[model samples]
Target: MELTPPEFTDYDTRLGAYAVIVRDDHVLLALWDEPEVPILMWSLPGGGVELDETPAEGAVREVREETGYDVELTGLLGVETFVMAPEKRFARVGDRPQKNVQVVYEATVTGGELTHEVGGSTSEARWIPLAEVPALERIGLIRKFIG
Candidate 1:
């Protein structure tokens, strides 16, 4: 099969807000299914910040969508920045670097059930043991929160 680049514009950029939700020895994570890979990559449960929402609000919303858990922000963890070039695995267009500004927060689950996001970026939600996280295929953001 031949691989071609996806479409993008020079103005494309993204602002994301993610959360670290931990209880006991487990952390909440989402499974991201890559079309080009056989194994699913793991990431923290969160996504892009909406135009009308604050990063904190977006964190709460994303966590709920990805993990089926209503969470309350406990603290601001840190910000991680990524610049994706066109030749990167995720980028389809190389006109400009896609600067991803990621804001992470520490949160606690207040309500909701364990579920997966439907028609979303992630396919499954799981609470994985902290000791096993290092062996998992994950996005760079995972290191920012755990490390």
Candidate 2:
């Protein structure tokens, strides 16, 4: 979530969808490597929901785009809402506190070869051992999946 001083009257809110794809003793994670953003971390393969798509559809599409794996969304895991001030780490177009709503879902890999996401926020998709997740440097959102 990104927040900044409210510069406009209209509320600034964004919707995002993510997937928790786990298999055997490993969990799927994407290496987020946004240009000009110094913060790099391993996170679930998902992104902002498109205007014409449902959250579930968005989750599936995002996972495929970021992880190069087709997925079937099984169930909604949870929804999280957060507001934060946007700074250099979370800059946006408007200087307003952004309300971010995240929808998390449980998904399973259906098909597709493992490949890096081209021209996207995430560069690599990997199935990391579950036991090693705790020690990895990642965004706080990771707790939602591992826990």
Backbone clashes, each candidate = 0, 4
Off by over 4 Å in 1: 1-11, 34-39, 89-94
Whole-model lDDT, model 1: 0.88
- Scored by CA lDDT, what does every candidate get? 0.88, 0.86
Worst 10 residues of 2 by lDDT: 86-95
The per-residue C-alpha lDDT of model 1 at residue 32 equals 86
How close to the true structure is residue 52 of candidate 1, measured as C-alpha lDDT? 100
Model 1 error, position 133 (Å): 0.6
RMSD (CA, Å), each prediction: 8.3, 5.9
lDDT of 1 at 123: 91
- TM-score of each prediction: 0.85, 0.88
Instruction: Give a tens-digit lDDT track for model 2, residues 89-108.
Output: 25576666778899999999
